[model samples]
Target: MASSPLNEGLISFLATHAPNDAFAETDPVKASQTLFPSTTYTDAERAEISQWVITSSHVGSPSEDAAKSAERLSSLNTHLSSRTTVLGAKPSVADIALYQKLAPVVSNWSPEERTGEQGYHHIVRHVDFVQNSPLFGLKLADKVNIDVDNVIFKIKPIDAKAEKERKKKEKEAAAAASAAASGTATPTTLTGEPAPEGKKGKKEKAKGAAQAAGEAVASIATGKPTAAPEDAQTKKKEKKEKQPKPQKPAPVEKPLSPALIDLRVGHILKAERHPNADSLFVSTIACGDPAGTDNTSEYEGQVVRTVCSGLNGLVPLEEMQNRKIVAVCNLKPVTMRGIKSAAMVLAASPRVVEGEDSHKGPVELVNPPTDAKAGDRVYFEGWEGEPEAVLNPKKKIWESIQPGFTTTDSLEVGFDVEAVPQLSGEGADKKTGVGKLKTAAGLCTVTTLKGATVR
Candidate 1:
């Protein structure tokens, strides 16, 4: 109802992006419809966006307590820790309202106040992200300068698998304590039956058997022919022996994580159109394999993989030559047309909607940091678990995890854990987060595509 920077930013964005609409509108709830008019949202998202728009107005209000404002800021930071925008991966008018209010406040904060070990670092990151990210379409020339590398504290991301295990152990321990309190936790033997308390105990049974053995020995030594006792001993020994049981085949090992895919930084040595296949490109890539590796040969004295990617028409041939890239190195070798491909090049393309062609153009090859040498390890953050030497195709290990591969709003490649339902744990253990793909050098990224699928 009153003039404010938050309201102005929202109106200005609506005017620029949707100028045909009424720029004089003052109601934030009504103005939101014009910001992204074509972007239809679910009922839940509409409700959330409306709530956030109102919440944005309270951040710098004169009546708001400083403590309350700090608490709210902290909550926003935590919410954005695992997400690129307030609506997780989706953009909305809420982000613009929030950015207008906080960006100015963030610009005035000192280094210690913005990125100190105990500062609102995530909030600062979000502010910088909004302005630079193309999703918002804000290209201000005097944008606040942010140093992403000057992070004062690196927060360890929440580990969903470890958290799931911790909760399971707590639940089991609580059940055990409850059973003990009821006084019904029966003592049991190794075979899962109630222990015999009044019968011949283990010690007594052993003594009786020893006595029988000694008596038999005396009878034999004294030349007393005890036919019944000898026959009884024979029957007892026979009773203890039985046919060997068949061993159960070893349990099939489930693929534990995305780390099972052996991702590596690779440098292409040569690239050419496939002689037999019109849509494929054959590339010789150096991926740090040891000499004499199977399906590998020497190229310029470096062990290289013959990788065939279906990028002939998607990515230019010049871009594929002598460039650093990320690749899946552990897949089973498959012959493409007439050439054997030992690895698959990683790339990013827009997600295919229900009716759209999945193989249309605009695919971008994933670029590893320039300093990253061929064969350097690349993995999703918080998922640095060791990779399989050679992925088992029968298990479909790569297929199960590849769906989680995605590009961030900032063009960084990452893996969204919730996309893989099987690995996302059960009920309360369910999780959601994006682990950015990285090597020791830096993050893997695309040229310009945002929110695309990386495979």
Candidate 2:
């Protein structure tokens, strides 16, 4: 009731008409409590007006709820009929408040265009009337003529010190250019072109001639040629090649530490099709917090997480319940089709191909060992670490390591590749290539299925 738009409109109207009245207050912070009195919705007109304040500048599309709100407003508009305002023969706050919300739409539509829409006729008329009314303090043409596309507003001023520093850089560049010209030096130029041959070039040539003359005289007096012009340029080229190329350090697998992954054995407590998404299944999984902390307030000690998985067509609904699976517990939560997924269930499937649903083949579950309990941590043989408190969804941590996630010919799940460990080798000496999945966690298996990738 406090958020009722009808009450808000009524307050605005009253405020304009009776500036001194207590109920006419308009300051948001001051009138918050008073604007929507307990009886705001008791009035039929106010309640109907409240329903019309549906859309806002922020909302782009009308959701299902928004559609219902529009319908409610239409019904009220029909009841108001030919009235200039929402409630009666006179303009009121309800008209002003509602006009503001629908102004964008109404001002854009022609009168005939408004009638073409089911509910716009009354709303457009109301907007036209409000803008013309004195209560708004402006005429309709003036108010509706705002140039939204050309809007301009002052931005924050630059910091004084920053402005000063920027000016200093400009002055320094100018001074340097002046000094280069005055010193007759062929200043270092960024264009990679020699400085224009002017006075500077003539000076340099004359200086070179004097040096050459001195060198020749000394060579003649010593009965030895000035050391043959050095092959300095050639030596430089050779030196560059001799400098060993910087070997690219082998790509280190910065996998989310096992601790960061919070991989735990979990049982699907229940599974159901998500109401809002056709390809997703909403499941309740039971897995303890990897950090081993009590999460009773949020998890309620049920050790349960709701996961939304795209397993609808591949995994049968009935087969999902009570199935033992591995869950990544530290991945950031995501809202899919309005359902908040708290964890992700790990599965193995053929590498995903764009625009192709792999559900056509077996999207197998990476199951937990038969004897493993729900809280048991899943770890690879050589890689040891814990799940980070929260996984960064945006960072490609999972994407970086996902290629390594693989199944052996025996259907074992692990990081199915190898390379010379980073610490064991140097630059070009480093070795890397395909290797075996190095996990000691007992393979999760189904008694009936064999030699299949767990996806």
Candidate 3:
């Protein structure tokens, strides 16, 4: 059977995208055992570059190790001489791998370093060539597109040394715990070894027997059982009385007000990767006709909004497809990576762990109830507002409002309304002694996911 043309096409595609291994053999014989040696070798090279170069260095702060990483890369690029791309005369998987790794660090470099004053002229040229390459299908001339300088490349490795140390500590802890359980040493004893049972035990036994004999004699003399020594009885009584009694705590109450901003239930109609940004998704959301839709204006009755979300690495595409979600409807539309985003999706995720993937955990969408239709107003019990046509980013309205947007005890996403004195002097009859807010009204949330954080 003959190989299809797809074999060469695939080779070229992988060469440009996937790249070679991070630690492949530079030797031609060992490298050529596989078809696409460039891809294998380059992939290995990227892994080494990411681990040694990016992971070891702190972002925004260039350390000694970072300088060393840069120097190593410079030397390797210098070896490439006047070559146009990585591996050979044309671009290969190796070029893509190296380009992606170097671009982030180099883009953040000072002007002098970028211009080859740092002796990385070859690296600078390669980065520029790859950035301008047409293979990624990005229209990068647009200012809103992703800027490589802002990217932080993180690679997490389960360190063997750290793991070994953890195990050693665990073993030591277990041994200490076992010794404690067996009462290997008593608190009162001065010696390192366990106190001898013969000396202490014999002395206590002899003293107790003498006391008992003395008591018996006294009882016979008195013609009745003698009472315990007053001091000893008092001490025992006091000891029993000194124990603490557990107390239940009083309940705490929170004040409430109406929701501050406009939130709506939205359904994701379509989701696709942004052409110009690696970590962004261009999505179309169906929110139904908003409150003020009329025949005269485009903003009026607009049921669908285009949103640009940074859920690329955080959420799986399959999870996002046709899912019901919560959205901030009034945020001012902005151009992101050349795409106009009209709304913002709401999601919840755990705090990021350093050196680990930020998207490693589950990213749950803030979903609305099935009964809540699209475009239905999401507001607090006591607050009310017609949705703003456009919120100002410069004023930071969203930032101010964001902190208060959270899930209630009922698991519904709503505003954390403030408590104010009732104007009618009906505070005495109110449940909260002032104004109280309901747990769920028009908010977007799911009953089953109660107490989940909505970010």
Candidate 4:
């Protein structure tokens, strides 16, 4: 039902080599007559030719048929050369027809002469006869016109001057129509106007009169003038008079004494598990920009820097290499399990049920949120900073400095506590009190205090 590759190749070969007479039944009897014409050869020669054609048709099978086909093919080649012109001589229709039929067979010949000088010479002679001979040329020309409908040769030159004049006339007509619709004139029109000032002034006056008359008629019909009513005018004046005096500009808001650290997207270049910590990995991250160094003094030749994080607790070390991730590069360094962890990797976790295989289990996936990346400055909506202060602040406070005054007993309260005093004399009056002050935690807890609430 389907054509095999060999068949398709054969068909393509035949179509190209014998394009003029591609169809098997191109002239039926005429084709058959050309290859085995009755008048040209004797009955014995015709019978031999018929046997040769039969043999060539069955050449694919390696039997007596193939041997016969080979012999017949050779006979056909000799017969063609003997009957028709060869080398550089004139060619006949029979020569063209025979050439097309034999070209496919000749293509399969040994490389020594398959497509060598002899074949080349035969083709050149045929092409020359088709091109130059009047009868063959007429047939080819007619076929070309029927198929392509265009001349191949550039026999005549185009009239450039006439073409330019035609295009110029069309452009001028378009310009005139455009100018008339726009109420403008071509440059040449201004020179043609007699009494230019008088004509222009009259036109302007006529336009103004027409607009005024239209407004007047509208006002009369609607019983309301197009201009503001007297009441509206009075109201506007009264409102302007009642307007408040402009207040002085508020004092310039100072920039907060804090830094806003940026979280940027970066690609991982290298990754290694922490020597002692199985849950953490040390990864070298490259943020792509050479100017985005966190520590300018320490990192000189490095386009990428190493940061130890708890990624091994999540993703495997092998999977982390060459992966893109979002990281908080400006966080203050802290030693985790004897390894220095410089930044945090942001990830999202999905809930997983128990008994699920670990490979198929739900795990947190790390991704850059909202097109964010490493070395990109993340900010609190209304906060200003050097990014690092926001990322790693030393302290955070929300104390109300102004205290309330009460009419009760005098209580000497320490900064640590605000409760009523239960003692008197030296115990209550002691200003030098020693209290344990807790150290401020890192940026995470401070950020949690300032607007980053867990839901």
**Global CA lDDT of candidate 4, please?**
0.38
Expressed as tens digits, the lDDT of each residue in 1-455 for candidate 1 is 23222366567755664333635566543455554443456777767777787787776554779899878888887677555567664566677778777877788878877788768776787787677654356657577788877877777755668767666645544543444344433222111233344565555544443444444344534646333221132222346668899999996664679988899998898899999998999999988776446788755435689999999889999988878899899999999887999999999999988999888969999989876777789999998878888897888888899999999998999999999998887699898899999998899999999989888
Better of 1 and 3 by TM-score: 1
Per-candidate clashes, comma-separated: 0, 16, 24, 12
Segments of candidate 4 deviating more than 4 angstroms: 1-259, 288-302, 350-363, 369-386, 389-393, 396-455
lDDT of 4 at 443: 21
lDDT of 4 by residue, 1-455 (tens): 11112233333433443334433433322333432221244454434434433333443234446667656544444433322233112222334443434444443444333233333222322333333332222233222111112223222223558657656645544554454445453223222222223334545534433443444445544556454211121222334457678999995543322123344566666788888887678877755333333432112122455677655755667877766665656666677777565565544332235775333322333333333333444322223344432232443211121011011111111022221121112465642321211112102111111111110
RMSD of 1: 21.7
lDDT of 3 at 179: 43
Ranking, lDDT, top scorer first: 1, 2, 3, 4
Most accurate candidate by lDDT? 1
lDDT of each prediction vs. the true structure?
0.74, 0.52, 0.50, 0.38
Indicate which candidate wins on TM-score. 1
In candidate 3, what are the lDDT values of residues 1-455, reduced to their tens digit?
11112223323433443324312433222323232322233555444433322322232234447777656665665544434444333233345445545656776666555543344555565666565533222233322122334323322323558667666645544543444444442311211222334445644544443454455444544546544422222222334446667887874322222343467667676798999998888877766543223211111112367888888877787777777777777777788988888788888654444787656546667767655545545555555545455555675556654544455565565544222332222445543311212223334554444444455
Q: Choose 1 or 4, whichever is better by lDDT.
A: 1
| Least accurate 10 contiguous residues by lDDT in model 1 | 227-236
- Which should have the higher TM-score, number 2 or number 3? 2
Candidate 2 residue-wise lDDT at 305: 74
TM match of model 2 to true structure: 0.38
**Cα deviation of 288 in candidate 3 (Å)?**
2.1
